[model samples]
Target: MAAGLVELAGVGLEVERPVRTRILHPIWLTIPEGARVSLVGPSGAGKTTLASIVGALQPASEGEYLFRGERVDLLDAKARAGFRADNVGFVFQNAHLIDERSALQNVALGIIDPTVEADEVTGRCLAALQQVGLAEVADRKAALLSGGERQRVAIARALVKGPRLVIADEPTGALDQTNGKAVLELLFSLDATLLLVTHDLAAAELADQVVTIVDGTLA
Candidate 1:
């Protein structure tokens, strides 16, 4: 059977104020396996909004979204939660780790495996951290890490799930030149298909396709 990784057909969204203004138009895009695609546009150009739809975090106002060929544009709240847990991982502009937990614990939260033992989870988390060259800091609390270190931990968390597709939102927005490159390297290292939202033209060049969004439309 053919794998239908992600498909957005005639998707449209609108953010209305009390005046009912239309903010976003329909977007049509597709992502096949192992394809690294970057969505680029200026702020408020609906880039993040589009990513949210693909991640199944937001329902489409008018369109169809298929993940692995399953219709997901209209799932209810609970079903969307389950669908995301099984098929997707998101790395936002911020690390979003729990400050109270250790670095390894934060990564384990990505999987939420009920069957996996605590020690086993730690092992997998540690392994992922090591892959990001963060093994030595695995036991430290998330609050104590530097911004760059925290982002690496976030990257490790996203990879630990072994998701089919990884969606990153400005994965390097908070890092300096050196740290941004480090985080970017770790993100692309995953064999999974990558759909990243970045303003960096340089990073976008590495993608199989560079989709530029302008004024809520693809240019």
Candidate 2:
């Protein structure tokens, strides 16, 4: 098999305390570089938990997580943050834009690499917005944009960094069918590896592989 861009070996999540609860059961999954994968499940089925682990937003409670053969689960919180900044792009159900910032500025905020020059950042942000067909709305504040336009700007922000992996959690949950489909189309068209968590079956079908989660385990 080709080397996995992301590998989760016996990985799981649990909250240990007065009353311990397992959010995810042991999962062994491998997504090769540039692969498109969707995780589908009902609410509270642990799909989001699994995606969070993969995205470096949450630490695994057991086993290991590797990105490009490097162990990410071993990194400290600060290191994990930097690691995610360098490699992962995220699109959530909400646009999560800074309402005060313009579409162009919002996308530019995604350029987290301090080493990149200011001019290059602006150039890349503009290109990304253009790629998502939001060039015309680049000057509009995020709060002034419509739902679909805001979501496109969110996508532009996610892709502006040119990340190796993109993790989208219910990216279309808040939009109408037409807008949702358009958003998914844009997400799948990206060059990066995609691991999407969604409740929509039709959206799941757009992926190269669909993995279903039931309760706390993959089914």
Q: Which candidate achieves the best TM-score against the true structure?
A: 2
When summed lDDT is taken over every stretch of 10 residues in candidate 2, the lowest stretch is 13-22
TM-score of each: 0.93, 0.97
lDDT of 2 by residue, 103-148 (tens): 9999998888788998898889999999999898888999999888
Runs in model 1 lying further than 4 Å from the true structure: 1-4
Residues 1-219, candidate 1: write the lDDT tens digits.
Answer: 334589888787865667765556787888887788899999988888888888889887887888878899879988998888887888887999999899998999887669988888888899989988999998899999988999989888988877888899998998899989888887887778889999999988888879888877788
Which pairs clash inside model 1?
A: none
C-alpha lDDT of all candidate models, in order: 0.86, 0.92
List of clashing residue pairs for candidate 2: none
Model 1 root mean square deviation, Cα atoms: 1.9
What is the alpha-carbon lDDT for the whole of candidate 1? Answer: 0.86
Give the Å shift of residue 16 in candidate 1.
Answer: 4.5
Each prediction's number of clashing residue pairs: 0, 0
